[model samples]
Target: MYDYAVIGGGIVGLAAAIAVGKRYPTARIVVLEKEQTWASHQTGNNSGVIHSGIYYKPGSYKAQFCREGNRSMVEFCQQHNIAHEVCGKVIVATEQHELPILENLYQRGLANGLKVNQLSAQQVKEIEPHVQCLAGLRVPSTGIVDYKQVCQKYVEIFQAQAGELRLNTQVQKITSRSDYTVLETNNGTFETRFVINCAGLHSDRIARLTKANPEAKIVPFRGEYYELKPEKRYLVNSLIYPVPNPAFPFLGVHFTRMIDGTVHAGPNAVLSFKREGYHKTDFNLRDLTEVMTYSGFWKLAAKHASEGLQEMVRSYSKTAFVRSLQRLIPEVTEADVIPTHAGVRAQALRPDGQLVDDFLLVSSQNALHVCNAPSPAATSSLEIGKAIASKIPEQSLLASSDCCLVTTNS
Candidate 1:
């Protein structure tokens, strides 16, 4: 019998399991992953940008965790000798009409307690000589790191603490007993005192296994990206993001200079047919049906119809994508970039068609389910893990400590 079972071997899952180990050193904690490898999904395919929490709303989990995570993640990389860069990023306004909105973003960054600087077009050029913008907001704390490496270190730490990790162990069902939870998996059946569901794309389904209905459903949005060709890499020195459309949930197309010296650009958000689908043609009938049948998805589609259509057009046409990238860097052309890998984001949408904007944790009987964690999740992972671990009930399971603090209503 294990004290804790963590599903999913992604970065968040590993970090969470590690945190639990630190909290209860004598407890038997196991990390269960469906895939043989770690962080092969969201963590591996992420843009590798460490967010500064400037875009999130003040007093929200994303804001607080992201701000703290930026520092902790950097510290972890530094201590472990991981490859990372604290290269600052600039949010630029290309058109004259976007200047006021840029100012609002600057103010929002300040509200979030970030040391941001409002920049004139000339000042923006001083930082990124190849870019053209009417105004800019420089975020100094933004950085990049390979989360897979970070997960590797987390695995080392957990294993050193005598934690167990079972790869290729996909959870099939969950049964809650009076004292412990029974988890039926492909590998074997296991009984544990508690379960932590960190199954990124499949988190909601895992929650349902315990007979808990998470108010929101996971909808996969594929973020398509392109890398600047070897010859054109010099155009981007660091990250350059456009002022995101407040009406849209996604942070629009942007340029990023990765840690390896190659620059990546244009992660246009488009609906993915499969939760694990990375390519345009990749499809899964069940996944498509769930999305098509979801009223919330249809409502969200209707709400962002225009932007959605544009994203679809750009997905099919390289010229259109290049044109979108040209907004941030006018010099980028069709020949300047090559198609790169894509990462699907599991965004949670409520039945009322409203998107869950914060990191959602739902506490069920003997289980804590991470229902919604997207975008900055990779950046806010360490803090998120600590938060989840801190809320776990004591090993003895007292009458007063029954359920964890569920952030979102179930």
Candidate 2:
């Protein structure tokens, strides 16, 4: 029997295991991943942007963790000799109506204690020659990195500390007993004193298996992207984002110059028929029926029907997607970009039809469930892991006091 059994081998799960091993050296920890490889889902298919704490509400978990996580992530990258860039990004206002929203963002950034500066159209041009904007907020702390590589390093350090990893291991059911939690998986049965559920896409399902009621349901929204043609990459200097529409949960289509020197644009959010569906044609009947019958999904759909329709249009029409991109960079055309891989976001929605905008953690007798961790999660993995580790019950730690103590160098 192990002391702790972590579900999912994504970045968050790996980070949690690493943090647990650090805090309790004697505890036996194991991470179970359904996929044969780590980060094969959200962690691997992300835009790989290291977000600054500018967009989140001040004093919120997103803001605090993002602020601290940015520092820790950069430090961790440097310590491991990983390739990363602290290149800044710009949130621009191309239309007159967007100016006020841009100003509000600047004020929010300031309130969050970031070194943000506003730039005029000419100043914006100076930074991004091909971009046209009436005003912009330059966020110097925003950066980019290969999160997959980072997750790999996390696994390496975690395994070096004696943490066991079981890939291609799907948890079929979970039962909590008086003393321990029993997990029945496709591979076999395992017993552990405690369980941490970080099973991103199917987190709610996992929680239900443990006999806990997750207040929110997981709704999968696919974000499709496009990469600029090699010769057209010069049109984007770094990252260029539009003034976010408050009515929408998405950040809208943006241009990002990746660490590999390729420029990626888009990520228009559309409802996915399958939880793991990466292509438009991919569909799952069970996943479809769940969302169709959910009251929260219908309520949310009714509220944002127009925006949702527009997203669907963009998903099918390259011209419409290019037009959206033209708002930030006027020179981008449909011919200049090619469709790339899409990522599915496991967004948590409440019964009242509201999206869970913050980091959500639900705890039971001897288990904790991370029901919602979207967007900046990849950037906030380390701090989120530390936070989850700190919440593990004291009794669990005391129970493993007699095991062999082995502190990790990481």
Candidate 3:
């Protein structure tokens, strides 16, 4: 029997396990992953950008965790001798009409407590010679690092502390008793005093299995990308982002220079027919049926139909995607980029059609579920884990409710 069992070996789960071990040094802990390796899904398939918390709302969980996580992540990397660079990013407005939007984003960055440098046309040109912009905001804390490496480092630390890891073990069901919880997995059965569900793609389903009333349902949005040709990579020096459309959940297409020195563009967001689908044709009837039947899905679709259509168009037409990129870098052409790997985002949507923008954590007496951990999650994984571990009542001497009451009074 283990004191704690964390589901999912992704960055979030590994971070959670690490935190538990640190907080309770002698506690027996196990991390369960259904895949053969850690970060086999979302964590492995991402444009590795260490976000600076410039885009999140001020005082929100996202802003708090990301800002702190940026610091902690860099420190961890430095301590581990990981290769990373604090190469700043720029959000540019290429057209005259986009200038005000760029200014607004600068204000938001300031509100989020980020160091924002508003740049003129000449300053933007100096940073990225090939790019054209009416205005821009320089976010110096943004950088890039391989998240897969970070996850591996977590595993090494966890194992060094004698924590256990179980891979290729799909969790089938979870049954809770008054004293402990029995988790049924394809590999075997395990009983633990506490369970933390960090299953990224299947988090909602796992919560439902444990009888937690999660506020939103996970809807997979596939972000498709293209890699710039080797010689044509000069379009971006670091990361060039677009002024986000407030109505849409996704940040528009832009340029990102990966840690490997290759540049990638696009990532048009479309309704993925299947949860794990990487291609436009890949579909699963079961997944499709679930999403189609859910009332919240329809509400979400109806609310963003126009933007969804445009995303679909860009997904199919390389030229259309190039046009979106051309807004930032005028020289990019369809031939400059080639199709690349795609990752599905596990977006949580409320019944009222509002996208859950921040981290969503649901807790019960015996279990804690992370239902929504979107962008910047990788950057904030360590901090997020520490935060979650702090919430585990058994680790604290004072009663959970009493502590909360005191917190409120204080």
TM-score top scorer: 1
> Which regions of candidate 3 fall more than 4 Å away from where they truly are?
395-410
Alpha-carbon shift of residue 222 in model 1 (angstroms)? 0.4
How close is every model to the real structure, measured as TM-score? 0.97, 0.96, 0.96
TM-score of 3: 0.96
Per-residue lDDT tens digits for candidate 1, residues 1-410, read 99999999988899898888888788899999999899989999999999999989898889999999999999999999999999999999988788888888988899999999988999999999988888899999999888888889999998999999899999998888887999999999999999899999999999988877788899999999999999999898889999999899889999998888988997998999999999999999999999999999999999999999999999999999999999988989998899998999989899888999998888777788888888798888889899888888675342222232353314
Q: If ranked by TM-score, best first, what sequence of candidates would result?
A: 1, 2, 3
Please, what are the lDDT tens digits per residue for candidate 3 over residues 178-268? Answer: 7788999999999998888899888988888878767688889999999999999876889999888877878889788998998889789
Clashes of each: 0, 0, 0
Clashing pairs in 3: none
**Judged by TM-score relative to the true structure, which candidate is superior, 1 or 2?**
1
Off by over 4 Å in 2: 396-410
Q: Candidate 3: RMSD over Cα atoms?
A: 3.2
* lDDT for each residue of candidate 2 in 301-354, tens digit (9 for 90 to 100): 999999999999999999999999998888888899999989999999999999
- Against the reference, the lDDT scores of all candidates come to 0.89, 0.90, 0.87
RMSD of each: 2.1, 5.3, 3.2
Instruction: Give the lDDT of residue 94 in candidate 1.
Output: 89
